[model samples]
Target: MLLCFALSRCAVSPTGDKLYITNLYEDKLLTLARDGTLLATFKDPALDGPYGLYVTPAGQVLVCERLSFSKLQMDSEDRSKLATLATRERDGVRYPMSVCYSSTTTSIIVGQWVNDNILVFRVE
Candidate 1:
């Protein structure tokens, strides 16, 4: 399938106070202040290699990793740990490279890196 890919490697919170960035080679996620000061760095077992990111309208953070069995993980509201959004099989997408949430449609959209495909999951 011919699909458009949108990389989401960095994002700013809805409040505009913080920035979230993924280090593609280091397997780490960084949180920064608007002034470019590092606030925190997170490393999660769920993340193989961080690639892309998406911040929800409500300020929720989601990450896309590069491994074949990669994930779409949501950052806990406290910005501490990452929680998997769904099981691997249920995600139905491989090699995720981008993530986005649609409030109007109540859905999650995923883009792949290894292949030209986009996955859309409705959120209830």
Candidate 2:
């Protein structure tokens, strides 16, 4: 049997024309168009077991790594780039399971897999 992909999470873009998917085992992110065409593939160096995905209104994809416990940014311009965020506490962000952007607080909320605690980071 041939292994296809290790897709773990997916989130639709703000405009609802694109879909962002996270591959946990492969350590990559895939962006697909509305018509199911592969737009881009992001293989960031910091993508250590990425498990969660969140897309901002300005067309930014936030990736949550399970092992690194860090939030990496994937901007619209560069599809194959991941920049680690520094605003997060980084202390107890272990096993980041999921991510969601809260517009009310202008922050990114991340939920862990093991500890069951949520970490909130305000993007400045």
Candidate 3:
């Protein structure tokens, strides 16, 4: 199925078989099969202005909440919140607009849009 999104950022699955998209204007994450069929939509109050998406080797989804300056993790299978990984003041992450997981280094790298800095957190 073909879906239309106003503003979206996408990340390829770790296995390279699917796509995960952050529907920024809609506050949701969309999962699409390789063939472009809509698989699922993930939505939550915490997903405010979700701007970035990254899939981990363990099949975890990392989301960057631009408006909230928070990072969230969810199970790729069920789209259930695994944790609120980081918050603005608590973690010193500001205006996080993009995210990527590094399996080799076991860390998550965040691009702070407003702060103009990149932060790396070790996965623990």
Candidate 4:
């Protein structure tokens, strides 16, 4: 299927061979080859309105769930493991629209779109 709307953010794999895209309207994540070949589509109820996407050095895919204001992490290759790292109401996240994992600092940064703030959390 062609990605037409709500294509929020994208990230390239550490190896630069794959592309990961977040579709907010469709509530799914798309994996594509470097040559734009469709590889896989990941859809889950927990993945509501995914916006920003980041590929960590360890090959973890981090996604920002816009409407939910949550951060989700999954295995980049297969998305076998999915976890909610944070939430707005419980974790002080307010409308998170973007996310990035810092290997050097061992932390995750979330961009709070509506609240106009940035939240940083140290990862263990």
lDDT of each: 0.68, 0.73, 0.75, 0.77
Off by over 4 Å in 3: 1-5, 67-77
Write out the backbone clash pairs for model 3: none
Cα error, residue 74 of model 3, in Å, equals: 5.9
* Total backbone clashes of candidate 3, pairs 3 or more residues apart or in separate chains: 0
User: By TM-score, who's the top model here?
Assistant: 4
Q: lDDT by residue for model 1 over 92-114, one digit each (tens)?
A: 55778778899889988888877
Model 4 lDDT per residue over 1-124, tens place: 5557678889998888889888888988888889998887888877788888888887778888864433334444555435677876678766787788888899999887887788888988
Runs off by more than 4 Å, candidate 4: 67-77
Q: 86 in model 4: Cα distance from truth in Å?
A: 0.2
Which has the higher TM-score value, candidate number 2 or candidate number 4? 4
Evaluation by lDDT, superior candidate among 2 and 3: 3
TM for candidate 2 is: 0.82
Cα RMSDs, all models: 6.8, 3.0, 2.7, 2.3
Q: Clash pairs of candidate 4?
A: none
Could you give me the TM-score of model 1 versus the true structure?
0.78
User: Among these predicted structures, which one has the highest lDDT?
Assistant: 4
